[model samples]
Structures are given as structure tokens and as C-alpha cells.
Target chain A: MLDGLIVSIDAMGGDDAPEIVIEGIEYFLKHEGKGRRARFLLHGDQPRLDKLLKKNPLTRERSEVCHSPTEIAMDEKPSQALRKGKGTSMWNAILAVKEGRANTVLSAGNTGALMAMSMLQLRRMHGIQRPALAANWPRPEGISVVLDVGANVEATASQLAEFAVLGDAFYRALFKKEHPSIGLLNVGTEDQKGHAVIKAAHERLAESDIGLNYKGYVEGNDISFGNTDVVVTDGFTGNVALKTAEGTAKLIGKFFNEALQGNPWSKFTTMLNSVALIKLKKRIDPRGVNGGVFLGLNGIVIKSHGGTDKVGYSNALNVAIGLAGSNFLEEIEREVERLHDEDDNIGFIE
Target chain B: MLDGLIVSIDAMGGDDAPEIVIEGIEYFLKHEGKGRRARFLLHGDQPRLDKLLKKNPLTRERSEVCHSPTEIAMDEKPSQALRKGKGTSMWNAILAVKEGRANTVLSAGNTGALMAMSMLQLRRMHGIQRPALAANWPRPEGISVVLDVGANVEATASQLAEFAVLGDAFYRALFKKEHPSIGLLNVGTEDQKGHAVIKAAHERLAESDIGLNYKGYVEGNDISFGNTDVVVTDGFTGNVALKTAEGTAKLIGKFFNEALQGNPWSKFTTMLNSVALIKLKKRIDPRGVNGGVFLGLNGIVIKSHGGTDKVGYSNALNVAIGLAGSNFLEEIEREVERLHDEDDNIGFIE
Candidate 1:
């Protein structure tokens, strides 16, 4: 289904560098049969990537290496990286998407640097004031898309409305849904709740004809309860909420593990139920969903965690490939145009 | 230690009503020895409360029922509840604190109504612009005090500083820590991160000498990781983060249960490990830390979850008694005065 799709990879970005990045590519191609139809444009140190690719025959057969001498340091500031990051691997991968050499860009680099480079290179979409970073939040029902995780610190009322439209289109493209339920993440579900920006956004979203299934307001608990398909908010609060959830999950896991290993009875029981425990761990593992998609940009950019291993890096590749195959950028463009036209009509009516 | 401390209870506030309220009192006094040192002022339907208290001799001996014919509905709006809330159990409980009949008030009712009544009856402290809701978040190391959970939707920089002082005093009073490490919650640990209000607050906190051990910025994950003794933020973000953590915990618990019940082998192992699992659950139970302390007010008020049962309500009662015995309101007043004097000095320096 993804035949001829090319994904640009920053092989020098993550902790393990070319080794894990190349292994991740091999794992994805070997485990996911549809992945065989995809091609790769790997950017990194030429000699290092060449040696790693030589070890993985399958990946070597389906990939082409682009020699990039420079690499962005994991702790480099975004402004500093942008100023001196012309030929770096992370920059090259993003540039490939802008040059039409690849459909999407995937990097496990410093988030700040990646965001800054992508914004400067790919630029924002026609009607977007700022780009949003979105993540797939796992819930009991399925998955919900939460946006503005950390791309921008603050968002205005119009910008929040824009995020709603952006998230709606992104979900529709990925899930093939005609209409996905959308919600503005707030402190409370009531109309009178939240601050002035959120209240104004709620009023605008409710009145606007953006073809969105806007479900007024949703609280923090509602995000994981699967109350809506897309939860949109300003980046600061969304980032805090996302990290808090991740931390809480980790804390609970730590508690569970300690409890199981504390005594002889628990140890024996854990050994007996190792299969079930493994299944549960795999189901909730953060590595399985380790990608933050950059929205409201002209090109697709998926950010993998900087410290993630092969399994996590592969998941990021899968996310990028799936989004590229779906032509997500085209969907966003159409949605943005439709919303603009609707707004103009509403102005005339008023 | 409670001695002659009196805690006013809203007997008709929660979903289970006077029965659970009276039962919770009994459970606390029975399980926690320190609970018996305190007295109770029950506000509710006099005949119903009288009949329930009659069944528990210990509770009957220490409690005095105040006839309150009306009760605040769980879904009543704040404005509506305030206009016609006179003589209602929730209102009477707060009034008892204002009238100096009780050291503190505990309510398991509509959060909006309770907040409105508390603000109307108790009023904000002399130098405090807004009151904050603080909760004891249990972590692996210990409990961290997180404030501004849902009292004010938006907080100014000055108000955030006020919350820091309030939370500092609160932690000191309850935990007897003369100087608790405090952190301002934000998207990142970097000083330059977050919005204008947060940035301003961070600068003010760093410069001002209100006897606070300000630990700079902390991210969402820090709250459960026990990075600081107190984590402060605007109520909107704080509420979202709190609920998100709760929702994530519930989701993980559900996943664990489903995985255990999937097969006979797993079920057998789960049965064998039931003791360890129960112990873990008890240790992390949300009910054990059920109350949200209303800080920055002239008097102390605690809000319990409306849907909680006897165990949860008992935990809330314990929290109320703890604060009452510690003289939390007076501590807050003292802290506010010190912060004001320090602010005046800083203004002169600038």
C-alpha cells in the first residue's frame, strides 16, 4: 500500500546513532510486510552508515545513504542549532521533505532543534499561524489525538480554533473517518469554565462551520477516557498534561514491579504469570507509540524520542510511513481552505 | 493532639448522604486513634442525622447535630447555590467555621457551590487575591503538595507567588517542615520556558525572600516523581494535570485487570498474587488522600470527592482534623504577612 513512498531518516540523531536507526529500519521491514513497499533516504555519517547498512542486507537493498558530515548535538539550543545547522543529518532529513525527495521526515533529535529547523525549512501552512506538535494518546476504547503538546507556549482563541481544524483533518486522514469528534481540552466541561482565550475559542468553534464534530469542552480526565477523538489545547497545558500522564504511568509500573518482586509468594506468582505480564507490558509500552507528529506545516515531520532504542525508533518510522501514505498534508490543505471559505461566508451573513 | 478542635461536616453533600457521612466519622474515630481527640458539628436533616448517629454510640457521644432542612444538590451552579443555599447543609458547614463554632469545614458536594460558599463566608486572606486548592499527591518517595488544582481558572503572576507562600505555609503546618522545597510547574525546566505569567512568577519567586525554598521550574512528570515538596501552577493547568494523572492510573488499572482475567492460567496466578496486588492497591488508593485543602482563605475548608464511599470520606475527615489541630489558617495568615513585607522591601530595592 505504501509503494514508492520515501521516508527520510536522521541516522545520527538518537542516542545509539546509526546502529539502532539502521536496526530499526530492518526490524520494521522484516516485521511489517507492508513496510517492504517503502524506500528510505538515510542521512548521517557516510562511512558509519555504510558499515551499518552492510550488516543489514535487507535495509541496504531498500535504502540510499546521503552523506552528512555535521550532526546536531542533543543539548544544543534551538536558536543556536538553526544558525549553524545547515548540513547536519537532522537538517538534511527535513530538507529532503521540502525538496520533494521524500514524503516525510523522521528524526530522534533534540525536539527544540528539530522543531526550529522544520519551521524554518518547511514553513507553516497557508493559513496556520503556528505549527502544533500532536501525539497519539492510548485509551481503553482506542486512540485519541492530542495536539499542541509543546510546539508553541501559548495559543490565542483563533489559533486554538485553527488547532481544532488541524487535528480534525489529521484524524480523518489517518483513520479514514468522515467526521471525528473534536474537543477543546479545558479545566471543566461546562461552557462558562476556563479562561478568556478558551471561552472565546469555544464560542468560535461552536459557531463556525468547519465541518468539525466539535464537542464543546472536555477536562483532563476526558482525554484518556476516550471522550473525544481529538483533544486540542495550547501547547503549555497540553505538554504538562501529557508528561504528567506518562510520569504517572511510569510511577504505577514501578510500584507494580516492586510489589511483585518484594517476596517469595509474589515472585512465584509473577513467574507463573510471565506470559500475561509480558502481554500487558507490550500493550502499554511507551515505545510502541513513540512519535510526536508536527501539524500545521506544509510537510510531515515526526519527532522520535532522543533517548529511545530500536523498538521505539521503528515505531516512529511506522508512524511517519503511515502518515505519508495517507497524503496527510493534502488533507490538511483542503480542510484549511474549506474553513477559510466558510469564515468568509459567515462574515457576509453577519 | 486534636484536643477541643471541632470539624463541621456537610451531612447531606455526597452521593451516599448522611448515612455515609456518619459512617465515615465512625470509621475514622475507630481506625485512627488521633481522630477521637476531635469533636464534630453535623449539619443536615435533623431527624435523619439523629437516627443515624443514634446507631453509633462513639459518634453520638462526640457529635452535635444542627438542624438544616435544605441540602445543596450535587449539580447546583455556584450562583444558584449561593442565592438559595441558606440553611443548606453545605452552607451551614461553612457558616459554622465563619461563626467560630468549628475550626474547619469538610464538604463532599458540588465543587463550584462549595468554592463559592467558602469565598463568600470565609473570604480571602488579607494580602491574598485568590485562594488555591492543594492536594497531597502520593509518590514513591513521599507525598508532594500540589496547589491551585481548581480554585481559580486563571492566575496572575502575583497570585501565583501568593500560592507559593500559601502552599509553603500549608506544608509546614501539616508536615512540620520549616522550609519545604517549592517549584513552579511549567512545560520545561528551563527558566525561559512557559508563558508570561509563569515567567514573571518565576523571576519574582527567585528574587523575593518570603522564607520559601523555591526550587525553580519543574515539569509535569516531577509531580509524581517527588521532585519537590510543593508544585504550584495556575488552576486550569493544575486541574488538567491532576485529572490526567488520575485518568491514566485508572486506565492502567483497567488494562491490568483485563490482562489478568484473559485466561485460566493468568487467573490462577492472579489469585495466588492477590495479597501483593491488594497491598499495592491499598498503598496507591486515591481515597487515602481524598481532600483538597482550600488555602489562602481566612479559614480552612476541605473538599472531598462527591462520589467517594466510606473509606474515602473517612480519609477526608482525617485530613480536616489534621489541619484543624495544626492551626493551618493562622499559619497562612502569618505567611501572607511575611510575603507582603518582603514584597514591599523588593519594591523599594527596584
Candidate 2:
């Protein structure tokens, strides 16, 4: 009886496999997915999925189980996963999308393995030389989209330009903004700062009239400050910046905990401020923004945090539904042609 | 009646130069520098420094004004600063060290300009190809030293090794740790992770017996977790990582402030937790760790934050005093000889 946008899921993915996946679907249905006509294709062990589904009637009623013989291990190498990844839950989930059986595919599995398998099965879009993995960053005000977080180790001048177009289009489609401002991640905001590749990209974007509202270069700190809607960078720097921010947030959380358990007076005061403190805690909770969308692909594939619980997984599922329902795929397709034109006209004077 | 551990001060460098520079010396002498035999040679506009010195009795008693005719502008390019930098406060401060008139030099000026002037005046050590900028990072527990933060854009395999040696020595000298553990900053901690330069450095550091307490690779979060005593990376990545962390901390502080302006109950409770909250603020305050030591040079030069106030400048003065007193200079010199051997023996198989 499920009759809307279908989402294929690798149920055997993540640290707490199958359990969180089933519970996540249940959480999504009762909460954010309440009235939406969204269904899921659960790909995992038949017996395990059956028992878990029985405990959650809503998910069991809406979803159809697609039996997968084997499961991919969390620590398996990408090459090994690619060599023998077929018929596995992760593989079958993507296969559903390839066969047009599902609107999108999602996995909380090994990132390298998933990227490799997704590339092999779904194939790249029209003119993307390298597909980017766009991750959401929680800013002081709202969320900002950062791309090429860890898709490729290095990015060329032309490829950085490609990311700007992809990121700009993706931001506009999801946020429904007429024009989303984009900025390149760099050491400094000045024109002459950072490496050769970044400088070249800045020059190209500043000159080209590709309809992107380019905001020039933004520093690492600017990502958290929400200076731009979308931030672009090479995979190496982006990955490091993302991890560093995560670590800083965790460290402060630990300090906050330790501060509360000090003197009796301090401990008593913390209880008095519990309501405001709770709001502060909820705002910074990592579970709120819990998905990385694999962009420039043939089909929509969301990669949730491997260690996230049911609540976190629900947020990622919400992201999947949000993107799948929008006209993002078509919008990106149009941008790709314009991007190709920009790619051919690079005249680096520096 | 000025005594031991003489530090040359660039009185006309920072945003609020001459004023904070004189007050910072006074603050240091009263607080951390109290009862210690520390003296300063203030380099800047004579009449301004002389007028400011009259306001501070302690600094007036111990410091001597070495009047420089001009000052380096905060945003001056390195090349431009170098071409016309003679007799300027920043230039003369480094010159004082070159002439052996002071034990160390401290500047709160243009970072690029300072680096360029320092390199030219003091020159590199016996085997140092590039001198690194060692910055202090506030951790949950104590502190960590991250190096090559914007000293150079990119680092080769051997240069990274040199950084490790310099960082290890720097950490030991500052913290008084017998064997400080050093970690190479990378996207992942795995042995097979990161770019070719990183992989080569990791292999060399892992196999070499260069008398360093090497802890292999560490991710970005590890820097805040106090997982290692020292974290080393190329200048560009290090600069980005440092700025990103600063921004995250600032964002969290903003959230806490907004959380308190909710309702009357929240406002009443905030006063109760004021003691503990103040303690938490102090724990993450940027002013506490204020200096970036220029490593691999013949002399010691501490770069105070350009925008920092008197309190922050005072902390930078403390760092200058700490290293100037210790044999950090000699320790780095000893390690440089061993690092040269590691550089020549780079047999990168992969």
C-alpha cells in the first residue's frame, strides 16, 4: 500500500547494523515522515529483518524486504569491497535505484566501499570528472553545505570550478533559494592567499557569468560562522576541517560536563539553568545534522554516519526524503552543461 | 636595574600598538614575571613609548626604550615590508637579537612581514631549509603545540620530519616533559591513509630512530582531545585547522549567550551558574595561549596575535620568557643533525 518516493536502504550497514536501521525507519515514520508518502526497501538478512519488522508495525506495514545473502564488513577495504561486493545488502540497495525500483539509495556503511560500489553501479552524470561528497555543517545561524569533503584527495583548478557549480545548484534546489552564495575554502580571504589551484579557481569564478553568486575565498573559521551558503574546497583540506570542528565541539561538551560536577553551589546552579542548557545542548547535538549526500551521481545516495543511533539515522532519512522530493537531479543536469562550457575556457595568466 | 632574560619588544606592531605593548610589559612584570629577573627593550616611536612608560611604574623601572623612527603596517605584504623595513619597530626588534643586544624578540605585527624580516635578519639554523611557526593550542586538559602554521604553503616528506623533530623539542622544552609524544596531522590515523608526501613522512617517522617519541598519525579531533603532546602538519593545513577550531569555539560561545536570553527562569538560573560558567569561559579563552614561536631560526621570536589586548600580549611575553630561559634553541639544534640523516634515508617503496 506504500505509494510515494521509495528509498532503498542497506539495513546491514552502520556500527549497530539492522537494529538501528529498523528502529530508524520507525522513528522517521512516527516523527518527520508522519504524513509523507515515503516507503523504504529494506535490504538485509531475511530472518533478522522479519523479526525486527514485527516489533515495529508501521515500518512492517509500509516497507518491502529485499533479501540479500551477505553483508559488507565495516572495516573492509574499498578495493576488496569492490572485488566481491555484489549480492550484499549495500550492493542490492543501490541496484534497486539502478533498476528504477527506488527513488534513492542510502547506506551507513564503509564510506570507501560505498563510494566505489556506487560509482561502479550508478556511473557518473553527464560531465562530472569527479563526483563530490557534500556534507552539511551546522553554522551559528543556519546550516551550510560544504562539498568535496573527502571524495578525492586533491582537486585541480578546473575541478574546483566544477564543485562550485555543483554545490551552488544543489544548495538552491534543496533550500529553494533563487541564488545561493558560494565561497572557496582557503587560508585567508584575500585574493592572493592560498595555493595556485585555489587562486586559479577564484579568478575563473570571479570572471565567469555562470549564474552562481560567488563570494570569493572564505577561511576555515568562516564555515562555522555561516559567511556563505555553500563552501567548496579540495577533499584533503575539507576532510581535515570537518574532523577538526567535530573534535572541538566534543572537547567543549566534555568541559561543560566537568564544570557541572564541581562544587555543590555550581551543581545546584546547573539544575536551575536546566531548561536553557537543554536548548543549548539540542542546538549543538550532532544527531540534528547527520547525513553526507554523494553529489554528481546518477542517483541520489545518502551516507549516514556509521556510528549514529536511531535518532541520528532518522534525520538522515529526512534528508533523503527532502532531496528526493525536490527537482535537484534535473537542476544539476542543467548546470552540468554550463559547467562544461566554463571548463573549456580556462585562461590562467598567473 | 633591569636584569636577566632580556626580551626585545616591537612596541609599534599590533593593532593597538605602543599602548598595549607597554601595558603588556607592565602586566607581565606584575603577574607572571613578578619576582623573576626579566627585562625588556621596547622598540617603537620614542615620544609615544616614553609617554606610555611614565604611566607604568614597574615597566618604567626595568625597561629601556630603543626608539625606532617608523613601524610596519599591519597589512603590508612581506616583500614590501622587507624592501623598506629598516629602523621600523618590527625590523629593529629582530635586529636587536641579531646584534646579541637581547636574548629574544617578540612581535605583534603582520605575520608574513615578521616572518620575512626574521628570516633575513637572523637567518636559518645550520641545516634548516625552512623555519616553522609553532603555535599553542588550548586542549581540554592542558595545551598542545601545532607547528608550521602558515610558515610555508606545502611541506615535502623530509620537511615534515624536520617539523616533527622541532615540535618534539619545542614541546619538551616548554612543558618540561622528558619524552613528549608527537603525531603527524592527517585525514585518518591509519598507516595507509593520506597523500604520498604524508605516507612517505609516516613511513620514515615510523621506521627511523631519531630519538623522538613518535605516536604515528592523528586525526583533527585528537588535537583538542590531548591525545598527543604535539601535532605536526604542513603550514597550509595547520593554519586552516587552527582557524577552524577557533571559529567553532566562538560559535558555541554565541549559542550559550543566545540560550540565556530565553525567559525569566533561564535568566535567574544563569546567575546561579555564573561561577561555573566563568570557569568554563576561562578554560576556552583565546587570550591564555597568545604566542606563535618562530622555530628553526638561530634566535627566538614570539609572534603575539595582531589583535590581542594587553592581557593576551602579556601571555606572549610569558612564552618568550619561558623559551628564552630554557635551552630550547640548543635542543632544536641537536635534533636538526639527526633530522638531516632521516631526510637522506627516505627510501619510499610505495
Candidate 1 has which clashing residue pairs, if any? Answer: none
**Candidates, DockQ:** 0.83, 0.80
| Runs off by more than 4 Å, candidate 2 | A345-350, B345-350
- All candidates' lDDT scores? 0.88, 0.88
Query: Per-residue lDDT of B195-281 in model 1, one digit per residue for the tens?
Result: 888998999899887678999999999999856999999999999999999999888888888888889999999999998898789
Per-residue lDDT for B288 in model 2? 94
**Residue B49 shift from truth in candidate 1, angstroms:** 1.1
- TM-score list, all predictions: 0.97, 0.97
Candidate 1 off by > 4 Å: A1-3, A33-35, A348-350, B1-3, B348-350
